[model samples]
Target chain A: MSDHKIDTHKIDTHKIDTHKIDKRDWDAHPPYVYPDYKSTTFRGPTKPLVPIAHTLSELTIPAFGHEQIQEFDNDLTINGRVDGEPQGERIQVSGRVLDEYGRPQIGTLVEIWQANAAGRYIHKTDQHDAPIDPNFFGGGRCVTDENGRYTFLSIKPGAYPWGNHHNAWRPNHIHFSLFGMSFASRLVTQMYFPGDPLLALDPIFNATADKIARESLVSKFSQKYSIPNIALGYEFDIVLRGPAATPMEA
Target chain B: MMSNKLKQTPSQTVGPFFSYALTPEQSGYNLKSIASPDMRADDTPGEHINLSGKIYDGNGEIVSDAMIEIWQTDADGNYLDRDTPPMDGTFTGFGRCDCEIKKEFYFNTVKPGPIEEGHAPHINMIVFMRGMLTHAYTRIYFSDESDANEKDAVFKSVPTERRHTIIANRVEEDNIVTYQFDLHMQGDNETVFFDV
Candidate 1:
C-alpha cells in the first residue's frame, strides 16, 4: 500500500509522466467547461472557482474488453434501425482513430447518435414541429479495425430548430463517442458536413476558439470512398490527446 | 509511411440532446445495456444498498440536466474482466442514471468488494451534464470502512479535509442500507472530481 501512495496535491496537471500525455490547454476549446464562453448558461465560474487538477488516480487505465464487447457491425443501418432500413439518403461515414502523433488507435470503441432525416429526435422532450422517424433510433456503435478505421451507414441528419436564439438551427451533424485507450482517451464530439450554411450561426461549433480546430470537425467528401451509384462517402479522422491534442469537449 | 499531417477534430458536448438515443427511457423505449444505474441481485452475496444524491453547480443551485454512471466490482472483491466472469450471471458491475426534474440521481447497487488488496470498498463514478464538455470521474468510498479507508491507496491520496466529499453516509431504514452522497460541481467543499 505504501508503494501505491501518492501525494495528489503535489502533482501538476502538466508533466505527469504516464500513459496520458500532459495536455493542460486542451480544455480551452470546450465552451461550457471553460469560463471563456459568456453566452451559455452554467458556464464555468469566472473567479473564486478553481477546478481541481488531474492526478495519477484520476487517469483510469482502460480495462481489457472495455472497447470490445458492444461492438456492432460497420453498418449501423443493419441492426440498429427499426426494420433494417431507414428513410433518407443513405450515407457512408468512415474514419480512422488516431493519436495526436497520427498513430493508429486500433480496437477502440466509437459510438454515435443523431437526429432522423426530419431533424427530430425520438424523444419525449423533443417537441419540435418535425416528425420523428419510426425506423431510425439514431444510435449505433462500432470498434476501430486493425488499421484504426471504422465505418457507419446511416441517413443524413437534418438541421433542426433550436431555442438558443429567436430561430436558431443546428447544422447537419452526427454525434460521436470514442474511448481510445483510457479514461484520458475518452472523447465525445459531433461531425459536421462541409459547406453547411448553418455552421457559421451555430454556437456549439463556433465554441471552439481555434479556427483550425473547429474546421477539423467538418468531414470532407471523398471520391475514393464513394460507392458508385450507392451512398456518398464522407471521411473524418479523429485524434486523441497529445502534443497536438484534439480540442475536445471539456 | 504517411506524413500524419491530418489535423485532429474538435470535440463537442453530448449536450442535453442525447436522451432520445443514449437514454431510451426518455424516448418511451426500454433498451437495456451495461449502463443501467443498478447492478445488484437479490440472491447475490453482499450487502444491498441504494445511493442517492443531488448535483450542484458553483452557485449551489441544482444541475437539473445531469447524468451519473457507476462501476464497481462484485461482492467478493472480484471485477468483471475479460478473463474474470461475474460470480454469477446477475452481477454486471455497471450502471447509469440521469437526474430528473429534482436534479437528483441515485443508484441501487451492492457494496463493491475491494478491487485490490489494502483498498476500501468503493464505487467508481462518472458524471456528465449539459454544461460539462467531458465527464467528471470520482469514487464513492464507504464511510463505515474506516480501517480499510485508512490504508486505501486512493483514499490516502485525498487531502484529509476533503476526503469526506467522496465518503458516503451509511444509513439503514426498514432493513435496507442506503448511502447518501451529494456532488458539488464547484465552490467550497465541491465534490472531488478526477480528470479521468
Candidate 2:
C-alpha cells in the first residue's frame, strides 16, 4: 500500500550471472584424497583450499620435440651396465601411453627411476643396510613411438624399509614421469610389481582411496613381452587423464 | 557426473632422494643421464632475461625439495612442434629447474611471445615436489604487458583482484633484465592454478 516504487537502476544482472563465467566444471579428474591419511598428515600442503580457474594455457600448450629426448635412453639394461652386468631379476617393462578415450599419445616422453635389486638407491639419503650395486644406476628414459608404445629394460627394484611407522616397509616399485601433449597433460605415478606383500601396508600406495584404482598401479607379468630366459616382462599402460585415466600423484 | 568414490592416490614428497634421480648430480653414472633443463643457446634471439622465484608452502616456508618445469613459446610466439629435426637450433620449448636450499629457482631464457594476438605474454609452469601427488600447473604473466593482459581471454577470465599473483615484476640493471614471481601454495596470496 506504500507509494514508493521499485528502482530498476539499482539492480545488476551481471552480478547474478557471474557463476556462469567464473565457475568451471572439472568432471573428469579424480577427487583429491582426504587429508587424514597418516603420511599426508605431516607432508600434505595445509593451506586453505583455493579454487583454480580453467585457462586456455592448460589446454593449448605445445607438445615438445625430439630435442627433449636423447638417443639410447630407452635401454636401461646397458645404461646401468658399467663395471659388470647389474645383479637382479631383469625386467622388460613396456606399455602404451593412452588418453582417456584410449587414443595413443604418441611421442610422449617417459622417464623412470628406481632402487636396485638390493633395495638400496645410489643416493646418499638411502641409509638402508642393503648393499648398493656399483654397476646398477637404476634410471632410464624413453619416448613413445608412433603407436604410443614405450619400453624399458631394467632390473626389478627390491623392497626397502623406512621409519614411516613401526616396522613399515615399502613394496618394490618404480617411479614414472610422463610428459604428455601439454603441461597440463603431464603425469607422475609409481608402478608396483604384482604380488608384493608390502602393497597393502604401504601408506603411500594405500593413500589412493579406491581399491580398484589402487590395484591398477600393480603391473602384471606378461609372457608375451618376456624375452624367453633373458628377462621377465611386465605391462603397465598409463592413461594421462579423463575418467578411465590412471590414478596419478598430486 | 561420475561418482566421487574413486579417490586419487596420495602424493608423497619427492624427498631428499631426488637430488641425483631427477636433478643434475654426479653420484651415479645413470644419474647424470636423462633430460637436461637447459632451454636456451648462446645465439637464441630475443630479450635475454633471468626468470627467478622462490616457492612457499601453506605456512609461507620455503619448499627446497620442489622442482619447477616451464614451457614457453619462442619470442615469435611459435612452439617448436615439428616431428622432423629443428630448422633452427635456437628454440627448445621445455625446460626445468630444481629449487635450491633457499627454496629459490631460476631459468635463463628469452621472454616468451604472447600466446595469441592480443593475449598476455605468458609462460606455462608445472611444479613437482614432495607431498604433491600430482604436479600443480600455473602460468606466469608479464606485468609490463598490461594492455595485452587486459584483452587476453585467459587473463580476463581471472578475477581482477587475484590476477596480480601471477604477474612477474621486472627489473633492469647492468644491461640485463630479470623477472621475479613468487609462488604461494596457500594463504591469501595463493597462486592461481589452471585446470586443463
Candidate 3:
C-alpha cells in the first residue's frame, strides 16, 4: 500500500509466487500472541568493505560444497537443542539482529566460513596450519535472500595442533562473520564442537563457564541423510544481535 | 628436467580469518546461542520469497554458494511465542533463507511491529560459509518510512561510518526491504558481532 518502489540493479524479489517460504514454529505451550509494536529507528547507510566490483554485468560463480543443495526442512532438516538434549546431529548458534524491539528490516546479507577436512587455512597467519589438501578445497560463502535463508557447503574439518606441550592440540572448529542490514544486526563469533576433552585444556574454547553452551556449534549425524562414511552433515542456526542493546554490527 | 608438483594456491579469501575459532569467552555469544545440545530447534515458517542476487568476494568477485540466514521479530515486534504474557497468545520469532538458493526459497511474512524495549526495530542475521568462520551474526533494519523498522534501537546507535551495514533499501515494486551484507575479516570495515 506504500508508494515505495523496489530497488533495481539487482534480482527481483517476489518474482516466483509458488515457492513456499517456511513459517515460524510456535511453542506447544499456552499460546499468547503479544501486541504489535512499530519501530521509530531510522536505517543508516553502510559502505562496502570493498568495492562492488562484481556488478550486474559479470557474475562468475565459484564452485562450492557438494552438488546437493536442499532445503533445511525439505531435504536438510535441522535437529538442534530447541528439541531438548541434542543427540543425533545438532549444531548450536543463536543471536538476534534487532534492536530492543523485534522489528527487523528484510533483505540484509549474512555469511559464514570455516576450515577444511585437514584443519588448515589458505593463509600463513594460521599458527596451527597444516598442509592444504589437493582435491579437497574447503571454504564457502552465501547471502540472505528475502526469506532470510543463507547457506554454503564446507568439508568436515579435522583437529589441529597448537602447542608443543604433549596433547596440547585443539579440536575441530569453524569461524563466523555477519553483515547486518542495520547496525543492530551486525555480529561476529565462532561455533565449537561438543563432547571433546580438549575443551577443558584449550584456552580459546574454555573462555566461558557453560560448557554445554559452547559445544552448541558441533554438527550431528542424521541416519536419514548420514552417508555411511562419505560425509558428515550439520545445521547451524544463527541469531544476529538486532535492536537489542550491545549490537555487534556497529 | 625434473617434474615439479605445484600446491594449489587457493583464492585470496583463504586468509587467517577463515581458519579462526571462537574463544571460550564467546560461548553465550552470537554463534554459540544454541551452544547446548539440549535446546529446541524450531521450524521457520515457509512462505513465498523472490530474493535474488549475485555472490561476490572481498576483491569484488562473484563467490558462489555464499550461505545466508535472516531472523527477525514477527509482525508484533514480539518473537514468536517467546513470552507468556497473560493477556496475549504465543508469538515465536524466527525466519531463515539461504540466498545461495534460487527463487524457490521464498516466503510471505508480515512486517513485524516495534518491540516494547523502546529501541529501533531490527532483524537478526547470520552468514554461512566464506572461507572465514563457521557462522556470522548481524542485524537488518529499515528506513524510517517503513512501519516495522522505525522504533528499533540498535539501528540508531551505529556511527555514521557503520550505518550502511545496518539498514536496507526498500524496493517499492517488490514491496521488500533489501540490504546486501558483505562480510569481511581483518578488512577495512568488519561486521560487529557479540562476544557470547
Kindly indicate the candidate among 1 and 3 with the higher TM-score.
1
The residue ranges of model 2 lying beyond 4 angstroms of the native Cα positions read A1-56, A59-72, A242-250, B1-16, B19-21, B25-37, B82-86, B100-102
What is the C-alpha lDDT profile of model 1 across A83-192, one tens digit per residue?
55777887899988876555578877677778888897765567889887777777776767888898888888999987677778889999987766544556778999
Against the native complex, each candidate's DockQ, computed on alpha carbons, is 0.30, 0.19, 0.03
Top-TM-score candidate index: 2
Runs with alpha carbons beyond 4 Å of true place in candidate 3: A1-250, B1-55, B81-92, B102-108, B144-152, B174-196
TM-score of chain B of each: 0.88, 0.85, 0.54
Q: Compose the digit string of candidate 1's lDDT tens values, residues B1-196.
A: 1122333456677767675445554334544342555567678778889998988787778876766777677787766643455646666666667675346887778888886788788877777766676556688998799999999876787777888889999999999898999987766777776544
Instruction: Name the lDDT value of residue B90 in candidate 1.
Output: 66
Using DockQ as the measure, name the better of candidate 1 and candidate 2. 1
Give TM per candidate. Answer: 0.78, 0.81, 0.35
Ranking by TM-score: 2, 1, 3
Q: What CAPRI grade goes to candidate 3?
A: incorrect
* Cα shift from native, residue B145, model 3 (Å): 3.8
Over B1-196, each residue of candidate 3 has an lDDT whose tens digit, in order, gives: 0011111101111123432122111212113221111111233233212222343344544443334444445555544421222123222233343332241122234444555555455555444443432233455565543443444334444555666645544454564443333443223444543211
What would the DockQ be for model 2?
Answer: 0.19
Q: Report the C-alpha lDDT of model 2 over B131-178, residue by residue, as the tens digit.
A: 665556678999888888888777777788888988999999998888
